[model samples]
Target: MTDATRVSPFLGLPGAVEGEGPNAGAPAHYGALVAEQRPLERGGAVVDLGNLGVIRLRGADRLTWLDSLTSGLVRSLAPGESGETLLLDVQGRIEHAAAVLDDGESTWLVTEGTRADEFASWLDRMRFLLDVRVERADEIVAAVGVFGDRELGAAAPNGVPLVWHDEWASTRVGGVSYATTDAHPGRDWDLHVHLLERPALEALAERVRVGDVSAAGIDALEALRIAAWRPRLARDVDSRAIPHELDWTRSAVHLEKGCYRGQETVAKVHNLGRPPRRLVHLDLDGSLGALPAAGAVLHVAGDPDRAVVGQITSIGVHHENGPIALALVKRRLDPEAVLAADLDGEGITAAQTAIVSPEAGHAADVPRLPRLGRRSG
Candidate 1:
């Protein structure tokens, strides 16, 4: 076994290690921890998503203005209703991706923690002449995520939105005001519990009794996200990559919506056809050795030694599929092309994972050229 494969005492799971904490040097279960805690195998799992963004938009125009600016149809979100949405620039590149909930009095946007300030600033600029007030609620709110099949409680004013999504059995507990959204497995729900006190935060974490998926880690979550083909801000896309390249058109882009900042480019691309690149899944061929760093080149199928076809965005060992990765490949490459990557001097062959194919049923399509630039050669 490779030295990197050495198991640590902190996480009984194999190949675990401390990832980004005060205990950075400490050993912890990297992927196994996440898997054990995923809402699937076990009944529930808790993630301290305090690092994710929580933005509060209050004022009368909150609904109409937010719906006008973002990619989701948020004007329709009744109190308690929740949905995932994306904030895009004029070029159609994603600025931030969020799961939002409305509480009649206010709207809450929960996203990656790093995007809190940036999203707030962007939304603030778009609020010209509108009655909406945009503010980052990070200091006032604690974000936690829980996933399971169990039924939850009413979490909104008049119980309107919560009652609307009654089909899902998840709820928030505590005196703190907040918003709750129903979500799919591996698709975590954001609990923007109002942080009135420190003890309340600690108690909420304990009450939920979030069991760390002893096997799942950020790595595991990345693998699952890649398998599901979810795109993240900064990593999968930037000002350079359009939303379609990352397959975010489904939940992020509203084709029927009238107009917004990047609407022109988005509509042009949709009508003309062909996004710059296409997101693909990679089933990495290897043991539990190591993974390549982000942006590592993937060799093209027809010419592996010379031409590069794509780049890896995320990598990990999946609980069900073992070593795997997600990548953004040049569109010229065949959807079924055979590819391989260099992982620590070892040649790791990777088969294209099925993502956009129609057989998959929900696979997102590559937006046409007018919507995004031509694919990189």
Candidate 2:
């Protein structure tokens, strides 16, 4: 394995397995690993999530202020709804990716893990005259991601207090005061967000019979995200990666909302043309036990020795498909481009490839409706 894909010595056990591959145990490959270890009969076990950020939006201006600050149309969200948003700079680069959850009284912003305190404080400072408040929720709540079994999926319902009873594992996820049965038996699962219950969460984290789960580290999680064709922040994008470039204009940006930073650039580029690079998935066509390193050039087959496309950002070996990878290729490059290269003396080859098809970039040049509850003279 190259330095980029090298298994870290600091990580141990289950973390090692998840961090070792590109799928990070989310794709079919990781699913197989879970089967071998736990050998599930009715349900399957997924990885536990920790790399996420949580923030609370309070005060009277919570909804209006957040609507103005983020890319999504937050002003229209109802009590039980959740919307994804992006924080973009004036130059159109994304600073953060957030999932906003409305709970009638307040709003929650869950972002990819970063300096939670710092980000919350920075957002607070931006509120100046607006009657809005921001606070870090990392200390107040601990999160666990669970994906499998649609039957148990509703454990974390949108509007009500989270509660479940699945024999071995059951729990509650929210600000409510309640206890739950252990419904999780290493099967179809749900992400648990225990509020103001740090000790209980930690204790539960220990008792859960999840083997090889701890092995899936942040690196592995990233691999699974890429394999799933999910967009990641820094790896796939740079300071110049606008929402449109990431095909995130629809999911993250609010085209019909009032002006915000980067709105002009977003409007102009979107209306006039498409971004230069696009995020794509690749099936490496070689026996490389490890996948390609980030930023490794994808030399198209016919044009050997010349790079018609860019290199990889994420990679992993699949259970059914073998070696797989994700990269930001030049949009004009052929979807049928024969990707070939060598890593650590292993000849890397890829056949299958697909682009993430998000909604077309927005045209913000169109006039938007007035924002509600603006400070009126």
Leading candidate by lDDT: 1
- TM accuracy, model 1: 0.73
Regions of candidate 2 where Cα sits further than 4 Å from its true position = 1-43, 115-118, 148-196, 210-224, 302-305, 345-347, 356-377
List RMSD in Å for every model shown: 9.9, 11.4
Per-residue alpha-carbon lDDT of model 1 for 1-377, expressed as tens digits?
11232212233334555554312222324445545435533434433433455688899998888878877777877776666667778887777777777888888887666556778898898888989899876555544333333332323333443321211123222101011112333244222222222344445434433443322334434455555556677467656776666656655566777577787777666555566667777888766467677678888544735488788877666677777677877766777678877766666778885443312212225454554765676
Candidate 2 lDDT, 1-377, residue by residue in tens? 31232222222233233332322222222324422323222124333333445688878788878777767777766775656677788877788776677767667776655445556877988999888878876555544433333222221323543221111122112111011112211223222332223454444344332442332234433444444455666466666677655546534665657887777877676765556666667877654456667777777765645654766776655434556677766767767767776677555777735453322333424575678976656
Task: Report lDDT per candidate.
Answer: 0.57, 0.53
- Candidate no. 2 TM-score: 0.69
* Model 1 lDDT at residue 41: 31
Q: What is the lDDT for 98 in model 1?
A: 75
C-alpha displacement of 54 in model 2, angstroms? 1.4
User: Candidate 2, 348: how far from true, in Å?
Assistant: 1.6
Error of 1 at 315 (Å): 1.6
